[model samples]
Target chain A: MKKFMNTAETMVAESVDGFVRAHADFVVFGTDRQCVRRRHLTPGKVAVISGGGAGHEPMHIGFVGQGMLDAACVGHVFTSPTPGQIIGAIEEADNGAGCLLIVKNYDGDIMNFEMAMEMAAGRHAVEMVIVSDDIETARIGEGRGRRGVAGTLIVEKIVGAAAEQGRPLAELKLLGDGLNGRIRSMGVALTGVTVPHTQRSTFTLGATEIEMGVGIHGEPGHSRQPFSTADDIVRYLCETISRDIDVQPGTKALLFINGLGGTPPAELYLAFNAARRFMEERSIPVERSLVGTYVTSLDMQGLSATLALLTKEEMTLWDAPVATGALRW
Target chain B: MKKFMNTAETMVAESVDGFVRAHADFVVFGTDRQCVRRRHLTPGKVAVISGGGAGHEPMHIGFVGQGMLDAACVGHVFTSPTPGQIIGAIEEADNGAGCLLIVKNYDGDIMNFEMAMEMAAGRHAVEMVIVSDDIETARIGEGRGRRGVAGTLIVEKIVGAAAEQGRPLAELKLLGDGLNGRIRSMGVALTGVTVPHTQRSTFTLGATEIEMGVGIHGEPGHSRQPFSTADDIVRYLCETISRDIDVQPGTKALLFINGLGGTPPAELYLAFNAARRFMEERSIPVERSLVGTYVTSLDMQGLSATLALLTKEEMTLWDAPVATGALRW
Candidate 1:
């Protein structure tokens, strides 16, 4: 696979270092090298920290700044950070207001962040919010129930905004956990991801085949299907989301179309248009929309559709100002 | 070939419609369907207008908001917009102050924009700035001298800020033209781009080979070279740009690393780190840095590095607040 990287052992560290330098005005490395925290933290405000593998960028790292994540504990590509790294971020980001950990529903991620919280028990008041918004994984209902995907962005954004408003740790956790139930995401992979360490694609498909409901870490999706037109694919995704969540008529939604690294903006917009049309046909009004590569899968060729049923308050939070490397408004 | 598009004929229009809708708060469609203009235009401010083929998105279209282009006349994929469309955008964006066109250095774009300027001769005072910052094309010293690439964003951003400050048409033109000379850019392609219309890649390279100095429209570059590490590739790019223009040891530069659509944030930052090291070793300071996929070539697995020697004033202008779909701060 063709990629711009150094040795696999050093790729993540180099990338994290480069990222901090590029946005030095907005973020800084925590005492722990793997942890990145906001350059200017707001004291007395709930410090919201989130992280996972390094490959899904602009997700955790790009969200670190005012009105978003206070700190992000970056890990090796597609690998979870250790508990020590998580606690380092927690210690650095927490002011007097306490800390909230937003963890995606993943085996390694949950275990590590949980350990970090237990380790920091006496010193800090910590609350954890686990996001599980992947509809396909929910359908399986076996191990881990559901895996978080692009909808995690919505949770981060809304929760981060709330944290900036001086919300307490418990409130922030409730806000994030509430958002998880409202958000549903599903992705289709046209091509697999090549891990930096392996230098090989996690999976392969025929030229005209696609994997629907793929996980971010290159996990096998729901099933392989014949590649179809953009409208058809988006229609299927929208339908699945609507079916998973019993959407009544006239429900307001925040339709988010996320490119999985390799898809271009034009195609993302096409998917957005398709999703918008589908919502319209179902009498669902999309009050807010975000389309771009905010959450990604390490240069994987695909796109994900996220629908967050939003209340008026949630919509206000989503519309709140956020300034970060990947997202700003 | 696995692109998320409906059909080539409808792709641009659909995408444009989706874009305007997504950024409804920032931009709107002009009377002419192909033209996208700022939703709230400053009546007396010099209207800055730009356009090109569709593939390089978030360039002309995404720049159509406050502190940037007033309007963008979008064209078909890898094809220049018609003179009629250009005139339409000009008429829609122009106010009492006048209009300035930011045209990239391409034969079709130049010819069509020139024709549009003549067509709108007595109606609106019009001036054009041609940007050609490609170091590779300049070194060749043939044809169009140099072709504009990622550096066009710098010109638009700086000139757009100047226009917002009530610079006249002629002054804006001069500012944009002057910035072009200070900017130098070079790109490397790891994979070719597939046009939506053709459903075929424009070019192909061997697995272990890469194209250096490739153009935004997938044009042939200086030469194909053996694939190398990120540092080596970025070091070569920085050296070429530094040589093309006699970069002084103490010169302060704005190092911009742009993804060519498909490259992910991790790789881009790795490139940024390498470029930063190269500048540091040369004793040239990077006063500012912007790394992401601002300018793109439509799902081509590649990236470009742009170096703009910035003065204090230009740095201020670069940091000016911009609220657009793709870029905002």
Candidate 2:
């Protein structure tokens, strides 16, 4: 793999160290290892926290700042964080207003974060919200095994704005759940990621082939198909996501097109152009749009489309100001 | 080519359309052209206007917003803007405080923007500054043929802030020249970019080969050598830059490590870590650092390191609050 690391074992740790040192003015390392928290804690406000594997950068860690996540427990690449790390993040984020865990519905992540919640039961009030908005799974409507991908940013922004307003912990949890339920996303990959220490990629495909419905962490998708034009793939992504959500005439959404690591901003805009055209024709207006690389798998050449059907009121939350490294606006 | 576009001919135009529409709140297209300008113009302030070839995003276009660029003239992919487009951008940005055109030092761009100045003569006051900081060229010290790369962002930020402060056109021009002279950058590429409709990369390398000093637009570098570890490359880049500039014990600089499009943020931090270590050992302090994909090539799997030596006062300007889609604080 063409990676920049001393060792695969320390790559995540070293990245965390570099990130903490770079943003030292605005953030600090959490008390209990492998977590990033704000430099100053706000007392008696609902605290928002999220965590997952380390490879998907600017996700959990980059979201730790003024208006977004309060703390982020960084696990090993494509691996769940330890329960102790999650507990520490909860402690740092909790300011007596209680804390909320934004779990990304992977079996490993859900288990570890819940374990951390149980571990912190006596110290602070904590709640959990499972974000399973990835609609690539066969049981999309059932929402049982759906994985959370780029849509987590939507949940984080909405829930974070409400939490920053000092909403009660219960209200914040409900906000996350509601927003998560309304969000749907799917992705296509032109190339798979090669993890550090591995010379080969997780999966290989022909030069002119694309994988549809792929997961972020090198997970296999429903099918390996022929490579198509950007407009056609965007149309396919939009159609799949709309089927999983309710999109009728006059429905408004925050269309977020994310580059999964290797796609350039220009290409992302290309996808956005096609998605916007597709939405306009279908009579579903994209009320707001964010096109860039957000939650990315390490060096994965792909793009994901997320359409979060928004309530008129919720639109205000999504548009609310944020000051994170990745999602600042 | 693995690009996202409806057609190669319309790729740049379509991306501009989507970008203007996505950021419609903060920006708008020029009255009758492809240029992007602030939605609400601040007349009577020294307008900071910049433009060049597209593809290196978040540089000239993404830098547009509150405290940075007043207008950016975007051109076709890897091609300079037309004289008409640059003229329109100047007309939109100038509000009697005079307009400053920040042009990258490319033969085509210099020739075209200069032609535009001649076209807009007497209609609006205009002055120009050329940024030529890329040090990888054979005639590096001569500075005439040096192509401006990632270092252009530093020139834009420093000059933009001064312009926002209502500095006169002459002062902004001087600041742009001073900052551009103080910046130096070099890059290496692991993979070449495939322009739309080309169906092939600009260059090819063996599995374990890397091209040193590659330009942002797939321009050939000085040499292609065997792939090395991140630390080794960081060492090479730092040593080369330090030799070009002074690296005495007490020197302070802003170490900006940029991803050349396809390199992920994790890998960028990896590069940052190596650079920090190298600087620390040399006793050359990196007073401030900005790490992310600021300026990027289109799908070029590589990275560039830019070190802008700064005085004590310049850090405050770098830390100034600016709001744009790509950069915010």
* Best by the lDDT measure: 1
Q: Candidate 2: which stretches are off by over 4 Å? A: A138-143, A248-251, B138-143, B247-251
> Where is the poorest 10-residue window by lDDT in model 2 chain B?
B137-146
Q: Residue-wise lDDT of candidate 2 within B97-192, one digit each (tens)?
A: 888999888888998999989998988788999987788963534336788888888887877877877789988888777777778899988888
Q: List the residue pairs that clash in candidate 2.
A: B1-B199
- When summed lDDT is taken over every stretch of 10 residues in candidate 1 chain B, the lowest stretch is B243-252
Tens digit per residue, CA lDDT, model 1, B232-273: 899999998977776654446999999998998888999999
Residue A242 of model 2: what lDDT? 84
Judged by DockQ cut-offs, the docking class of candidate 1 is high
Question: Residue-wise lDDT of candidate 1 within A255-313, one digit each (tens)?
Answer: 99999988888889988999999989988788899999978899899999998898778
Docking level of model 2 = medium
Per-candidate Cα lDDT values, in order, are 0.88, 0.83
- Using DockQ, give the best candidate's number: 1
